[model samples]
Target: MDITCDFNTLPKNGHYKPLLEKEELKTQLLLNIRSCLSYLFPNGTFHGNEYRIGNLQGSKGKSLRVELTGNKAGLWNDFATGEGGDIIDLWAAAHRKDVKAEFHEVMASIGEWLGYYRQHKVNEAESTISWDYLDENGEAIVKVYRYDTALGKRYLPFDVKKSSYTAPEVRPLYNIPGIIKADKVIIVEGEKCAESLIKQGITATTAMSGANAPIDKTDWSPLKGKHIIIWPDNDEPGKQYAEKVAKKLIDLGVISLATVKIPQDKPIAWDAADCIQEGTNPLEFITNRKSPYHNNNSSNKLKKIDTSIWTNTAPERKWIIKDWLPVGSVTAVYGDGGVGKSLLAQQLMTAAAIGKSWLGIDIEQIKTYGVFCEDDEEELWRRQCTINAFYQLDMQSPAFLDNICLSSRVGENNLLMVFDNKGIGQLTPYFQELLADIELFQPKLVILDTAADLFGGNENDRSHVRQFIQNCCGHIAKTIKGAVLLCAHPSDSGIIRKTGTGGSTAWNNSVRSRWYLSKPDRADASDIDRVLCRKKSNYSASEQNQISFYWQNGAFVECNAHFNSERIVRNNYNKKLDLERGRRHDVILELIASEAYKGKVYTTAQFAKYFEGKLGLGSERSIRERISHLATIGHIKFFKRSPEHELSNTRSKYGYLCVEDMELKISEDQYVFIKPSCYLSATNGVLMPVENPNVWVTHNFIINDNFKLAE
Candidate 1:
């Protein structure tokens, strides 16, 4: 840390300066001795930390060649007058207080300076708990926490004088020293939570910026492939922060992750600190047995699904260009790198923003947020203007321009991240604020340009794929109640296979809608060779699975083919998509749980037929596997119906309720007819069967044993 030139240091205004403890007084005085000299003598001159001229030696002019450079730095001599003294004597002499007769008084005045340092220490607003944000070696680069006084608790740094505290750089996480050694690392929101959890023998860490710092903004690379659980502050921002971190961590390829979303009933913004303050064990709150997200092949995990809470019908599919762009879902637009992913998305956004339809496809006329990692605002504007000119739309119209919000990272700060002020990985804070901005605008569509930049994860890793899909497409889209258009690259071979670049099959599987834009025979391509084919369309409401659009006049318009899927033999249905079956498995089980609680029963085929194309689930085998997968995951139990209510013995059904829901009374309706199998309820955390005749179970069926929020 470079020290600031202390040419204008100030002396303790005696009786007014707060007194600091001995060590603190020494440190404060040493911090800027030149400042103290300047304060003592309104007539002293300084060059750097040394004296340039002094009135004590009567060398008021810059004639002295004396420098203050001894171990005591206070010892200085003027070559012109050969006068020298310790720093204290110089201070006393400069004040001209008649030090010979009032030596004690002069000394007392200096002592008063030390006492000034103590002022704030005794002030009720000062907190005693000093938290250090340490590096891997346990050396603190910065210390920050809150001060307790009549001013209440205030978040502040250890001292602003140190560059460690005030430099506009992102510091490492608090308690980073222990993160590597701990088998399990729990990431919390603030320093206070980090401290509280550490005291309970739990290893925890958090970076600077509270909820504002994204996980990518810090040195998370240290914890790469480490199993960790993220516990967020019990608030909206905290939860959002957690979601962002979780996604990035997956990108980092962490071994496992489980999020302990503190129960909703707790106070808002409550954190580990609150739990510790209330004498509650913080670690006890972590709910799930840690497992890698998405591919946790754990044999006994039960997920409780409640479709009843979901809207009776999913939201109507919204389109910017009919089937090509669906609202309230994640759509993947992939093409050859530097092809037209960004251009296609931009044209669609411009059309949507201006209430104009693209390729004559009716649009919902909604706003769009375009996050372009590739181009700066100026570049985006240049392209926007070109398109605007081609469309002959008024670019000056605030109604037209304001309908589109463009956030470009270009110029000097193109890669310099303010969110990750230190620039470790600025994604978290960047996206966190970006999403908040989206919420404010509530745009119907958000175009994220290029996963190559947004996702720092290996495009091929399944875990990274799951995390990204769940967060960006799942959580972000749901939060804004809009659609997300993710622009990405396809592998060099993707032109032939029809999937996006490096991203795993999970990326293709998780999104509600997907498209692969490419050209036929790149070596001999003609103007009309480009094809924007729908690779996946779970948003089954889309009108077409594929379309061929010609790039003309700086925008896409109908060419030889449009508004048709059959024309492009290779379409969404034909594309071999490797979608993750786990998510859908949970959905199927949840729907069955909802029906079972209402005393409805169904076999594998029956359940499959009922929910084939609804709830974003698909395929008979995929649906059938939901039963075994739910039982394997432990959300529900697999059981056989008794002879009285016979379903095939080979096929088991889950009608069991989790004890957490705990509604066991045989109201004339709770169980219209008692199946012969006994029910297992997790009472007092012990799985026990009811011997009383009232509650009867036909046979063992999957039950949601781990039914609490994995939040």
Candidate 2:
């Protein structure tokens, strides 16, 4: 390392003054000089160290004589007022004659030290008359310069007075708002907190240091006659400061002091500056709170309080039809048992997680969280297979399902997840805590499968269920600001599909959208499976045949063909097959005609008998085959029974519709004819309807006595 020293010229203070102790302090000066030499060489003795009085002609102070002896000795000398220039020449001559190099260096060092001491001592002593650098608080720092009698000069040995200085001016200690006119002072411990108060238009100040700063009457006099609020730091020191300041204010006749405690685990702080930066208003934090510390002293104080005061504004609701619920929406999917409710929910969860379509509905990318409260090994296996099929990976491996959370945490949003298998009430805190975790991670979508499993109370009670749903929805919306999909089970009556697992209307009312699904007829083998579009929506419910799909190889697949052989066999004798074959639109028209005539409609078997029995077919299969054919060709009509019909079995009725009910305006030249299977298809055993009847009628048909043949 290299070491070098340079110096700047000294600054001029008020005036220069000489000390009166030049001659009288000669002994003291001599001892101090001897001590400096001794410090340089601990084992050396002073050969000559003396103070001479009035040795200089123009200077008022005396000079010092110094010598050093460690392993060698050095001569001592003092220069007279005019000898500074002469001493240099004398020293050079003396070195040439007898002065050793090491001895000369030592003398030179002593000479520099004496020069610095005299200059600094004189400057410092003279400038101290007023102690102008210190404030009213009496804290001041001063540099010292001693008077130099030799050479009549002041010189610095080392530049110790570099950049160390503090000015005595008052800086605003508290940030006060310009709006507040009250002459009050609120003392705080932190400048940031004081600024926070200032944002509320409150004038407050903080101790430049902490509350421990030594403040006297002068420091405390600003609020002598004004109001004082002591909002201190949270810990013991702040409380102590409050007490101390309060006592002083009391003595000064200013006793209107209020103590406001901001409850916090760490240090309590309140003010405008700190909180305004956090995007909060200080006045709101003050006026918007109901004191948790309120006492029960009076009836007014004990009045009923609404608990929602401290709650933040609820997240805005999102109403989703075909799309994902908006960042804070609560959505529910519900159906009766075996209605694929869980499957549908889980599908949405995985789709959100992977950014895929759910039931062919387009979706934007988002993380999804799903939890299944009811999962058997089979269901789990099925779910895993579905995920694998959808992702087209090895579902057996843990990685495929890893993104899907089966445990409580359920990786962040739009990622597939599930929750506890047991009831919800038992895990309220656990759910709330999970919501907190969601806020931390910020997933895109959250799905809770089967609302019933999550709730522990009586699901039939609409009010209670609504409250629970609202609570869960509120947290999810507020924290995640993301969509929430809830899986639910419909009621036992099956009146509505979206009745949740809790079996309450509240579930459907709270949800934004609802979709229903059910099995359709199979005897009319040409018809597809049905998905009922029951509730309110902007779009039409998918055709029953179009929406019903199967979960195959881990993904939802649209079925090309549906086989309802059981239904076909069970109602083979009834004309229910006509509606199944897609003639229900005409059937409804037929019912209107029949009800208009007699205020009552016949069952499906009656219509089937009317159409086929007129042709004298003994087998019900033959009549059904004909009805199915006619219905498919849009020549005849069919209708399913309404629940109000007095059927022995609760099953809906099916029937043939009259020609008037068909609602057609035919021209005089057009006529419809029924043809045997041989005319339409060789493979089909049933008959079919044809638009032209002239050719078919010429082939065969006998005019009956009861029914006239139109010519």
Candidate 3:
């Protein structure tokens, strides 16, 4: 056997302590065997360096012979030697304390020595040094020994590789008189954390040296669900390193992970020694530390989003509300009147009824039966026919009709159509019922065609409308883990309005995504030639471009951009009103109050009725004129209906009032007239709802003189 790097490879007279003769021999023998076996059986099994020493073998027969294999091939010749041959000389040379040959070479060389004995008619004998050294196959098993240089004695195998194996050097620490069983396991970066924790009655272990130390796989198995608290250094790397280890514990099923954010201004705390020296109580820190997992759960609670509801007890992952549909979000799809918004909405509902993809968005289409409060069934069916013909979609596909739900075959929510369910109080129960059906369908998306029919009475009530939309969106997004695309009509001229139909900005305010469709110049060019502007978003990038869709007979096909108007409508109103630059900032509060009071009766007394406890203005006259000026700017509209005054049963209270144009106005009598509030301000005098405390006058115009107060 050729042993590698003996004492000769070390410095001759350095302070290095050389191995003893016996230890050297054992190390050489094992290294040679390992080196040879590793090369021969790279993938095949070979036990670790430790083994049991087996019996010595010698055979004497007429024609029996043995040869060397692997690295020991050059150790011996083909034939045995005797008498004049150099057999004795070579044997004496091979058995020297310093000489090393491969295990196979040594075996072959021994066989040659025996062959020499046979040629000379020497006697053969068999003896075993150890009883457990040989297997049934007569192969020699090696026994491993550790050299105790301190005592200069070889000890038996320690079985240190076991799960309970404590370092022999470090065992005395555990035997200390003051040692106590700690209620918590304090995991630290190094041995110092363990020592620091031990000082504080915490049983702890440093993950060896750093975060990357080797961990015993079996040792970690018992730690699952154990309370493991980690303290990282007050730096990015330390926090990241600690999180890495915590994740490993989590993967192995640890109870939870808590992080103690270290403030950077404090003295640097890299390891346990520093922490202890700085009087940092690692145990207390861990006990009081906020768990990242717990914080996440608590934050989710506020939005009524529960991740653990689906993660903890469920066999399969439960859908969280956030994953299904984000709270405070809106999603919309806009196209021309005849551009197939209804058809697409139906297809999406159908696809959601049977989990499938529409236009490449992965969604589980529920068995969605829409209520046709607006459209007739024939129109709906006609659209469906056109859709099927366009996409050549087979209705027989399992992805077509698994859990389909319908409210009305006419494609809408029927209850809302009849009852005008605009408030969350009224809509929640309805949505919950719909959600129950949606879950059965396991839909990933729902369709509410043209929001006008949905928020019937209070369509202009953005706050109320948004609350309802959020409830519906939240339920659908969470229960079925789906999305809701509410269809809405554009203004009469097809101009993009904040409120899609019924003109409530809240319609767009509550959706997560909003896609505005503009009329294509050439309708015949392609049904898909309309511009889709991503006017709002939370997840997707905000982009505006013309996306082409081709109405191939009846179905719409999305294609690569063939026509792009690349139009950017700068909302000057928004840009000018940004308070940061202070350009039109003075008007921000006015604009906000006007928007808040949108679509409501604005008589002086009614203003008090609407904003008594809310409007914090001192001068009522100024507030009224502010309303009048806002109306003049087209931000609001004032009306005087002939019989409008009696609608609220407060006849001629102010004789005329302002309301959002979209609001249905009822006239009571000829005396109760309905005209723009601007007409009242123009013909009679401005109605003052409040007064300004700090009034100013310019060279050209005086504040209170130019406009008189209305009676």
Write down the lDDT of every candidate, Cα atoms only.
0.58, 0.43, 0.42
Estimate the overall C-alpha local distance difference test score of candidate 3: 0.42
Q: Which stretches of model 3 miss by more than 4 angstroms?
A: 1-330, 334-337, 349-372, 375-379, 403-413, 416-424, 428-432, 491-501, 521-529, 559-711
Off by over 4 Å in 1: 1-22, 30-35, 46-109, 113-178, 181-329, 337-340, 371-392, 407-442, 451-479, 496-507, 518-526, 541-543, 549-552, 559-711
Q: What is candidate 2's local distance difference test score?
A: 0.43
The TM-score values for the models, in the order shown, are: 0.50, 0.35, 0.34
Once model 1 is optimally superposed onto the true structure by TM-score, how far is the C-alpha of residue 296 displaced, in angstroms?
25
Residue range 1-711, candidate 2, lDDT tens digits: 111111122336533321212211322323354554344333433234332333322123344233433211233344553332122232333344322444334333334454534333333334322211122343332222333443442311111233222111232233322213456676777545665676566777664444764445124544544556666666778778776765555544342445556666333544335456678664454344463222100112124677766567774444322433444556665566665666666666666555566665666555556666666556766675666577565655443344445433223232211222222122133553565566665566777766655665666544455545655554576466666766666553332111122344445555555544444434443323434333322233433322545555545555332544575456656634433333333233333333423433444455444545342343544545544443333333333332333323324222323322111112332212112212222223233343453222211211221221111
Candidate 1: C-alpha RMSD to true structure equals 17.7
Q: Which of the predicted structures, 1 or 2, would earn the higher TM-score when compared with the native?
A: 1
Q: Is candidate 1 or candidate 3 better by lDDT?
A: 1
lDDT (10s digit) by residue, model 3, range 205-261: 544324544443213443444455566665666666676665565445433344456
Q: Is candidate 1 or candidate 2 better by lDDT?
A: 1
| Highest lDDT scorer | 1
lDDT of 1 by residue, 446-524 (tens): 8888676677555655455655666544556767677788887876434433344333445665677777777643333
Question: Total backbone clashes of model 3?
Answer: 70
| Candidate order by decreasing lDDT | 1, 2, 3
Best by TM-score: 1
State the TM-score for model 1: 0.50
